[model samples]
Target: MSFKNLLLLCSIIWLGVSCKSEKEDPGPSGPGVPASFGFNSLKVNGAYSGFKYNDVNLKPKVRFTFSAPINNATVANGVTFQSASGEKIAFTSVQEGGDSSVVITPSADLKYLTSYSVTATKALKSKAGGMLLNEVKVELITALDATDKFPVISDEALLTLVQRQTFKYFWDFAHPVSGLARERDSSGDVVTSGGSGFGIMTIPIAIERKFITRAQGLERMQKIVSFLKKAQTFHGAFPHWLNGATGVVVPFSDKDNGADLVETSFLVQGLLTVRQYFNEGNAAETALRADINAIWEAVEWDWFRKNNENVLYWHWSPNFGWDMNHQIRGWNECLVTYALAASSPTHSIDKTVYDNGWAGNSTFRNGNEYYGTTLPLGEPLGGPLFFSHYSFLGLNPTGLTDRFANYFTQNKAHTLINYNYCKANPQQYYGYSDQCWGLTASDIPNGYNANSPSNDKGVITPTAALSAFPYTPTESMKALKFFYYKLGDKLWGEYGFRDAFSLDQLWFADTYLAIDQGPIVVMIENYRSGLPWKLCMSSPEVKTGLKKLGFTSPAL
Candidate 1:
């Protein structure tokens, strides 16, 4: 019981007390440690942001990783999901995320285009008994799937959905470097001038539909105009193709490295439409409008007149100088080239170019009768419907006429001829009926062709029919239903319809082209509300050019 014994006993008791306190009252991990018991990362359907479920057959899986190892009880009780309406969503299982994460698999396929909310509650605890510093909530939206039960959508609703989804190809999937439309899904860095033109016309549509805000659309427009300013040009015209990233000329062929007049005209058409659209006096909009106008005025349309000859050539390569040797004739998609050239204020063409060159020296007239319909200004069967579509996309066909024919009737007759030709089905293609009939320049089993009854290769380009919606709605609607509801499995994708489908070859395009997809959205909007035509025609230059060309419109 001496002083040594007392001191030793006291030391042992104090040491025991300190050790117990250390074990029982573990404080915060440290200042450097993250405060939340929630995940450092979270992925819904395998994407962190803008996750989309394209395949209707697949269920959605959400995976998350925590800052610290989470408790098993927290995993069981803390994670929950509700739809935008607060209705609970059942999950098949909550599994471990291997080391420090968790996975939740939905019990059923998520509804298309539906928004869902996922919540990790404050009850979620770390392995060390620390509660979640803040509850983690994620909002995700499911994309519209083709397999979803068909709701009774109005015709307008159907058209809007088709237009918006197709527009996404130009917006969401645009070229990473230049923000221009890619030539096709497979053409990695290649961008098309004509197709990009068609895409430009859809930007205003996107703004009107609220797919993007005016600021977002203007930002993209500025990028495009800025790129065009620095991009390669031949004779003040853009090439048929350009490298999307570096703004270099992408030779479409060995000799096609220079100015492409027809393609440039298409691009100018879109630029004018954009100029008309962003008319507000805001700094961003004013800058965009000025850039577009500068690009438009720079094109020397008269230079393409070929030594002031009657005919205008399609290409003028710096490497080969018109060696492609193609003429800008009518009864084809190049009508826009002539119209825009004649419309150009700075570099204008005389009406004689339209008359002798485009009208084939007054022989461009198509007096041929097919399927009891007469086309006034194109080859047999109106040369595959696009003759009616491409030019009229911005130029309102209603009340539009020259000396030869009324454009509206010409287009309608062309569509009916194409439709009737398919109904006749002389070639006995695998799928040609009232519900599926359109032949134009599109991919076939062999390759691309300008398909028509006379040139029937059994390929059906949906754009040939879809773009004709402005001309023939009833027939186009039939084709639309067949293409969407019946053939959605094969033809539809994350974007809307693929470029073309051939039943005879049992072939379907697994790709999309900017040219084909662009027309669908712009032309459909034109049919519904005349938005593009209104915007394009609003330009004073367009009015003057149309007058010079002897064109008249009731809308004017």
Candidate 2:
């Protein structure tokens, strides 16, 4: 008690003295005073770090700067710098100083007129190896402003459209087929030769690429080249589909039993014609031309001559009898169109035969009498039949500007008038037609009723025959501004475009794809640039087919 009381009184007196005095009162000396270890200083770098645009192109760079250098301490290993949005905007080059700094190179294109922040951190280690530090933040902006008149369909969007369609759906991280595999009816799912329909969806994407969004109309010329280079194939053909479980071609179409050069030819035509948009005599153009030529050569067109039909057969179904006489107009048009479009002064002689002879037969105008056999006994596949599948007519008479324009306008008007029946109401069919210029119609027949054949029911895909054709800018633009823009996310999907739009039904409830979009793209560019006309002039098939169909240069 006596010692404790004395010690307590001394402590109290020492505390009072220490508090009042300026000089330190060192209680008991410690060996080499331990350094103060705690979150004493907070530091950060204020710099905007993100991708910048040179005009519309991405300008890659790492941008970072520090507010002040760190002193008397080292940073922790796992400490990270991030943006306000919690994104890791780290610097590849980090240096500690009274002014600590880091530099980070962005992998993506930056938005114009935008700023970003950089952040840093410092950690003080205790003798126990535990850590203590405060996080820091900083920021800076790019120098370039967001005012560049770039192409409406920029590279970024193009890459995005292609990649998403191919990767997310077509190949499904597997491989794309090269040759023909399956035969698709107008309304069925476009499956592969092996009957494997589980692959990432390919039909809608193909349609949209060719038809709805023809903005980069000719840029797609390189797509086939890229596709061929990337496609995994057997015997010059592609698997019609990827098996969901096996990731291989499942053989879903009539052509699935064997290589289908006919479909390949159609695709090749699109690629070749579109290539003309690029500066001529360039490596890309030359390479594309060469690849397409090789592909055409590899195809055994003789394989198509079935049972001495003289015309190409639809497909070689392993299970069913080959799809013989059901010759689809759209497919036939592509084969002839692309072949003719690729004709050149150097190769015109061989290709021109298609233009001047049987292909030019006038019976085709009647839409009957192919190979001395009548078409499937149906009401002449009406207004929206062939036109709904491919915009071939749009690309056909491109050589004659006035005639082509007239045809295009008529075709577009017909599509507008037929699909969207509001323009032709009972009370206002004629006088009110002008009011519904941009509205597309439901696929329902003219006098559609619930009890009609299943195929007669109405269904409009957002990315249907209409949306993907970006060739007629004035018309497409008017339609886009009026229809697409107005529809917004309702009809438009996250992908580049959808299949069709439903005016009477739920917006995008049910949709299927056909080979619609691709031609739209080629046709738009062909008309806009007048390249298809030149190419057709170079081809015998086109001349022959045009003549056989009674189509003239002026195409009345």
For model 1, how many clashes? 0
Provide the clash count, candidate 2. Answer: 79
Model 1 TM-score on a 0 to 1 scale: 0.73
Residue-wise lDDT of candidate 1 within 1-556, one digit each (tens)? 5343466468556544654553444446686653444345667766664222222223677776666677777765788877777888887545465446777777877775456766778777777776665456666665435452345477788888899889988998899778899998889999999899999999999999888998899889999999999999977899999999988999888888889987888888898999999999988888888898888889888988778888898889876777788888876777778888888879999998888898864547878788898878777667776677777778888888888789889889988999998998876665688988998887777578878877888788888889989888999998988788767777888789998987655568888889889989999998888999999889898888888888888755
Model 1 stretches with alpha carbons more than 4 Å out: 1-152
TM-score of each: 0.73, 0.43
User: Which ten residues in a row are the worst by lDDT in model 1?
Assistant: 49-58
The top-ranked prediction according to lDDT is: 1
> 1-556 in candidate 2: lDDT tens per residue?
4343466568556534543331232222357643322222222223222221112222333332323333323433324434334665433443434333333344454443234543334453334333333333334333323232223454335433433442232322222233221222232233442211111112223334453233332233344244455554444444444332333445544446544434444444444333332335767656766675565444444444445343444455544556434442331233343233233222222323333332443433333322233332122322333333243422453232221123343344434433334333332211122222322223333322221111333343332233324323343444433333444444434333444443332234322232333333333333344444454344454455344433456532
lDDT of 1: 0.80
